[model samples]
Target chain A: MKIKKNIAISQSGFAFDPNSGDSFSLNPIATEIVNLLKDDKDEQFITSHILEKYEIDEFTFQRNFDDFVQMLKHYQFVE
Target chain B: MLPTYNIAITGLNNTDNPGPGVPVIRGLREAKSFKVNIIGLAYENLEPGIYLDGICDKVYQIPYPSAGSTAFIDRIKYIHEKENLDFIIPNFDAELFTFITSQDILSDLGIKTFLPTLEQFEERQKVNLPEYGKKYNVQVPNSKALTSLSEINDLRKEFDYPLLVKGKFYDAYLAYNPEQVINHFNKISAKWGLPVIVQAFAKGTEVNVIALGDGNGNTIGAVPMRKQYITDKGKAWGGITLGDEKLLELTRNIIKQTKWRGGMELEMIKTNTGEYFLIEINPRIPAWVYLANGAGQNLPEAMVNLGLGKEVIPYTSYEIGKMFVRYSQDLIVDLSIFEKLSMNGEL
Candidate 1:
C-alpha cells in the first residue's frame, strides 16, 4: 500500500503529511516504512525489505508491520 | 564541621548489577563529606568491594545465621548504635522483608528505614494496568490481571490473540494466539505466580519514564526515554529517548496517589489509539540508572541526598533525541544467541 499523498521526512526523523496535519517523530525503522509506502511497495516487498534490514524475526516482523499499519490507519495517514 | 552521617544500603546482593549497590556505593563515595558504611548479605562481595575501593568508610556483612531471624535486627542495631547511622535504605526486594518484619522494633534502634508496608508492597506489585490507568487518567490498554488459567478461558471471548502476558515488575511475553498464550502462561506461571496481566497487545512504540519520589508522592526527579533495543530476557540493552514534561506530570500524579516514595520506573506505550497508555509501575531503580544520571538527574544520588534530609539539586532537561547504548556482561551472552538467530533475521 502506498501513502497515497505527499510526505516529507526531515533528517531528524520528524515526519509531516500535508493531507493529515499529523506531525510526528518517526524512529529510523518507521521512517524506512514511510519511504516504502511512499514508493508504493506491496506488502510482500515491504516484508522482504524489512526482513533484509532489521534483526527481528519474520513472525515478529509481520506482527510489528501489521501493528504499524494499524497505527498508520489510526493516525488517519493511511486508508 | 562535615555533616557526619552513617548510612547503609541493604540487599546490595541482588543479581541485577552493577546492581543497585554499585550506584549506591558510588554515590556515597562521591559524597565524601558524609561518613557512610556499606551493609549487605554480600551477594557479590559488593560492600567490601566498594569499601576496599574507598567508596565507604566501613563494610559490614550480616551473618547468615542472623539473616531472616530476630538476630538480623540485632545486627542492624549493632551497626546503628556503633556508627550513629542516619538511615537504612533497602536495596533489593528481599531486604524489604527484614525491615518490614521488624519495622517497629528497628525504629527504636534510632535509624530511619525507607520502605512501604507489606500490603503496599503487594498492591504495588499487582499487574492491573487498566484500573491504575483510568484512576490516574493515564491511557493504558484494555487489560485485566488474570489470577488463574481458567480466567484466560473466560477472557478469551473478549480479548484476541497475540495477548501480552506480563510479569508485574519484570518481563513480558507476546503470544500471537490464544493457544500460544495459554502455553506460555502455564509454563511461566509454574515458575512465577499470578494474576498475570492479560491485555490486548499494543502494537506501538514503548517508552519508559524513571523518577524518584518523596514518600508523600511528589516527584523528586525524572528521566523519560524510549527503548532502543530489548533482549529476550526483556531487559533494555540499548535505548535512545528524550524527556517529556507532560509524561513527568502524569507520573507525578500516580506517585502522589500511591504515596510512593523512592525510585520508580513507569512504562508507557503510544498506541494506535493516538494516545499514550500507562502500562506498569516498577518501584525500584531500573537497570538504566547511569542513563538517567547522564540525562542530568542522578536519581540514586538524589535519593541518597533525600534520605539525609539534604536539599536536592535541581534537574535540567535532557537533550532531545539523545541515545544511549548499554553494555553489560549479560549482553555479550545475548549477542552470541542473537548472532545465531541473525541467520533467520528475526527473534
Candidate 2:
C-alpha cells in the first residue's frame, strides 16, 4: 500500500493533507509506518521491520498493523 | 534601554468567531517601550495564530480547561522551564476562571498575571447583569436566567414577543414566540449549559467600547466603536471609531465604580431616544481590539506594562473617525513547523 504523494508527513508525526486542509498527529511508530508507506513498502515488509525494532509479537503486530492501515484507509490517507 | 520579555498568550483561534490573541500580539509587538517574544498557548492544532508567522515566536498545545487545572498548570510549568515566561495573558472567557485561580501558583513560579478579582468577575456575569446594572446605577434591559425549559413560558409574561435568548458564555438568538424560544433554549443550553438568559429586546443601534482598568478605579484607555456592518455571526465586519461624550462618560463611570482590572469589552445598545442600554460585558479583550491600536491607544501594550509592574499613564484621547474593516487571509505553512509543534510540543 502507498500513501498519497501530496500528503505532507513530518518527522514529528504531523501529517497534513493539503487538498483537504486536514491535519493529524500520529504516534512515533505510526509516523515510521507512514514514511515506509510513502516509500511504497508492503505490509509484510513493514510488519517485519517494526517487529524487529519493537518488542511485539507477530500476531499483535499484525493486528495493530491491520488496524492502523485500515484507519489510514478510513481517513483516506492511503491509495 | 528597552527590557526584553517572554510573554505567553492564549486564545489563538482567529477563526470567523475570532479570538483576541493575534490582535493582542500585534498590539504588543508594535510597542515602543519594550521588546517582547510571544509564546502562544494554544488549545487546538488548527488554531490559525499557531501557524501565523510574526505573531508568536513559538507555540505549544495546552490541555482544555475541562481536562482539569492540574493538567493545564503542568503544561504551563513545563513551558515555563523551557521559555521562562515573564507573564501570561488569557483572552478566552472559558479559561479565565482557571487562569485567575492559578494566578497565585504562577506568581510562585515567577510568572505574573493581571486579571479581575473573582468578586469583580462574578458581578458582571450574564445571569447577574440586572443586579450589576442596579448596583452600578447603569441602564440595562430586564434579563433573567432560565435553568429549565418550563421557564421559557414564564419569560413571555414579563418579556414581550421578540425577546433575546442567550447562553451563559456565547450565542444569542432573538425569539419571536414560544417555539423559537424553546428551540434556542435547547440549542444554547446543550452547548453552554443551563441558566439560559432571556433579555427584553431593546431597539437600538449596537455600539461597543474596549476599555482597560488600572486595578484601582482608573481607566487606562477607552475606545468606542460603532459597527458599520455586521456579519451573520454578529461580528463587526466593518466599524468606525466615534467621539461620543456620553458613551465615554459611561465607560469611565463604570470602570471607576468597579475598580476593574485588565481588558474588557462593553457591549451596549443605543436607543432612538439617545439612551444606552448595557448588554454584555466580556471580561477579556474583544477580537476587534486591533482597531483600538489603529486608533492610537495601544491597550495591550499598557496591559503588558502593568503586568510587568511598570507605571503607565492614562491615555486621554484617541483619533476619532478611524475605521477598521476585517478581512481573512490564508497562510502557507511548512510541514516542519507543524512537526516541531506536534512531535516536540514546541515550534
Candidate 3:
C-alpha cells in the first residue's frame, strides 16, 4: 500500500488529507512508516527497515504495522 | 483583587453534533465576577475545541466514561493535583453518569461540581418522562423503554404509526411501521445500547429553554429559543430567543418541582393548539449555551460560584431576539500542537 499523493505529512507528524479536509496526527513510528510509504516503499520493505532500527521483533512489528496500515486505509490516508 | 477561578469542562467535540465546552468557556470568559482559566478535557485527539485559540488554557485527554468511573476519576485526580482545578462541568450525556457518581469523590479532592442529584437525573429520563409529566402536571407523550426486538410488537395498539425510535443517550428516527422500527432499533441500539425508547410523535414547533436552578426550588435563569433553521442532523443551525411567557413559566414550574441543581436544557414541543409537551431534559448545559450568555444569563459562571458555596440571585430579565447561527471554519493549527496532544495527551 502507498500513502496517497494528496496526503501531506508535516514536520511534527500531522497528516492532512487535502481532499477530505480532515487532519490527523501520528506517533513517531507511524510518522516513519507513512514517510516510507509516501516514498513508494512496500509493506515488506517498510517492515524490514523499521525492524532494523526499533527493538521490536519481526512478527510483533508486522502485526502492528498491518493494523496501522488498516487504520490509514480506513481513514483513506493510503491507497 | 478578585481571585481567578480555574475550571475544567468536557464535550469539546465541536463538530456537526457540537458540544457545550466552547460555549460554556465563552460564558466563563465573559463573566463579570472574576478572572477565569479554561481547562479543556477532551476524549478525542481532534475534538476541535482543543485546537481553537482563546478557548482553553490547557487541554488534556481523558479516558472516555465507557472506560468506567475508576479510570475516569483517576485521570481527573491527576489533572486536579497538577492544575488545582477548582470546578468541572461535564457536558456530555454519555459522561454525566460518571461525573455525577464521582461528585463526592472529586469534592473530597477539593474540586467542586454542581449537578443534578442521581434521583433527579433518573426521573427525567426519556423512558420516565410520562410519569415525570404526570407528577409535575405537564404534558408529555407516552413512551416505553424496550430491551428486546420482540418488544416492538403491538406498539401500535398503545401508540400509533410514525412514532419516534430513540436511543437512551442520543439519536432518534421516525418509524412508520414495525419493519422500520426494527431497522432503527438495531441501528441505534448498536451505537447507544438498549433499552431503546419509543415515544408517540408530537407534531409542533420545537422550542428549547436553557435553564439554571440554584438547587433550592428556585429558577435562577431561563432563556427560550425557537429554531428558525435546522441542519440535516436535526441540530438547530440558527435560532432566536423568544419572549414567550408560557415557555418561561413551564421552565420555572419544572425547576421548582424538581429543585434541579446546576444547568439543564428543556426540549419541548409547542403544539399548534398552544399546549407544551416536555420532550427531553439534558442534565448539563446545552451546545446552545452561548445563546443564553448572549441573552444576559451567565449560567456557567453562576454554577462555579454556587459550587464554591457563594450566593447567586435569580435572573429576572433578558433581551430577546438574539440569534445564534453556527458555522464551521478550519483553524490552521501547528503540527506540534497535534503532536503534543496526540502523543502526550496534553497541550
Write candidate 3's Cα lDDT for B40-153 as tens digits. 999999999998889999999999888989999889988988899988999999998888898889999999999999999999988889899999998998898999999888
**Best candidate per lDDT, number?**
2
To one decimal, what is the Cα RMSD in angstroms of model 3 from the true structure? 20.5
DockQ of 1: 0.04
How would the candidate models be sorted by lDDT, starting from the highest? 2, 3, 1
True contacts kept of 2: 0.00
Models sorted by TM-score, best on top: 3, 2, 1
TM values, all candidates: 0.66, 0.80, 0.81
CAPRI grade of model 2: incorrect
Model 2, B82-139: lDDT tens per residue? Answer: 9999989999998999999999999999999989989888899999999999999999
Q: What is the TM-score of chain B in candidate 1?
A: 0.76
Off by over 4 Å in 1: A1-79, B10-18, B32-35, B43-75, B78-85, B94-102, B116-122, B272-274, B313-316, B319-323, B329-347
lDDT comparison, 2 vs 3, better candidate: 2
> lDDT of each structure?
0.64, 0.90, 0.88
